[model samples]
Target: MTLTQRQAAYEAEVLRRWQDQSDGAHDLGHLRRVWRNCQTIALAEGGADTEVLLAAAFFHDLVNLPKNHPERAQASRLSARAAVDWLATQGFPAEKLPAVEHAIAAHSFSAAIPPETTEARILQDADRLEALGALGIARMFYVAGAMGGALFDADDPLASHRPLDDRAFALDHIEVKLLPLVHAMQTTEGRRMAEEGADWLMSFRSRLLREIG
Candidate 1:
């Protein structure tokens, strides 16, 4: 099969596997966005292996554990294993399998695995990029709602008094985690994009605080 045909088949299979098992924030749509981010980053950064990046993107969330799962940090490892097994059966390039596996394994923030290869770094950056900007705001609320987290703490929306607990309130996630990602992005393009997204998020917080007051 041609590369394009192979990718189409992979996309279909990925959708099938995910159809029954995905949550709002980690669904196929999220994968598509991440794939797009990878494409954009690869073009801008240069020297990234597109096949490995695309494979990693499609399979990175194969395990799809909830964010609050006790073993959340291990999800990426499990996803990597599953992707490798599936790709082996599909005749995905044997030479590139290790790169694909590494990229998937290191993509998760919770995994805390530093990406070692260009493909891995780009994949990591692409996935994290999703957790910023306008869509990031929407996704944060989607996850918070699913987890039964409140929009924010009315008494301390900025979490000045109480300990910041994203487990209970969605908005606190910005300061607790999301804002810090601005500096954590792995690629130059990703960092630039992250800065812009962080700026928007900060502006959003200002508007929200003023309205709450």
Candidate 2:
């Protein structure tokens, strides 16, 4: 599908802002992964504007500043604000604003804003889909290292029975969140990709456990 001039401009600016806002392991790279996943899924879903979906996909993680950082759990509405404002400037329909904002606002796993629209759901799934499989495994390690987390340890408190803090949560996300993502995808193609991703994670984790445990 084609994006109107407004939508095109809206997406481009959002990508630039996000690229500048965070980089590498922050939110920038993560946002691109979601955008890539959204594109993969959008191709199969049909009827959605690739650019608009890409716009939302790009801006989805635009939520939650680093002050809140990894796990402080703040509202992501501010993250969605820049995109919303630009869309308005592009003369994007006011009616569509909430849908876009809602998707952006809810994309965070922390915010727990489960997407309400078809676009939002796919966006949400795409972003989370990043946390599964091989790439997902790489991202988990990348973010953990970025946040100063320790390398694997059977005794790391992050692996505890849900009693750990945010630091632990970030480190332990591999087992707690990443592992289940394959089954959680909302699209059929996403599901297929997730299966491969999740399986790689499972095998990798199994080896880690056998050796590390």
Best TM-score among the predictions, by candidate number: 1
Off by over 4 Å in 2: 1-22, 26-29, 67-72, 154-166, 169-171, 209-213
lDDT of model 1 at position 8: 79
After superposition, the stretches of candidate 1 with alpha carbons farther than 4 Å from their true spots are none
Predictions in order: lDDT = 0.88, 0.67
The C-alpha TM-scores of every prediction are: 0.95, 0.76
Q: Candidate 1 lDDT (Cα, whole model)?
A: 0.88
The sequence of per-residue lDDT tens digits that candidate 2 reaches over residues 1-213 is 344553455456656765655445545556567777887787888655554576676666554455336653554667678777876776666777777787778777677776667777788778778777776677777677666766564466345554544344454666567766666667788788878887887787778767765
Could you tell me which 10 consecutive residues in candidate 2 have the lowest summed lDDT? 162-171
Residue by residue across 1-213, what tens digits does model 1's lDDT show? 775776677778777777777488887788888989999989999998888888899889988888879999999999999899999998888999999889999999988899999999999888888889888899899999999999999998988889999989999999888999989988899999999999989888899889889
Question: Candidate 1, 10: how far from true, in Å?
Answer: 1.9
Root-mean-square deviation (CA) per prediction: 1.3, 3.8
Model 2 CA RMSD to the hidden true structure, in angstroms:
3.8
- Which residue pairs does candidate 2 place in steric collision? 133-197
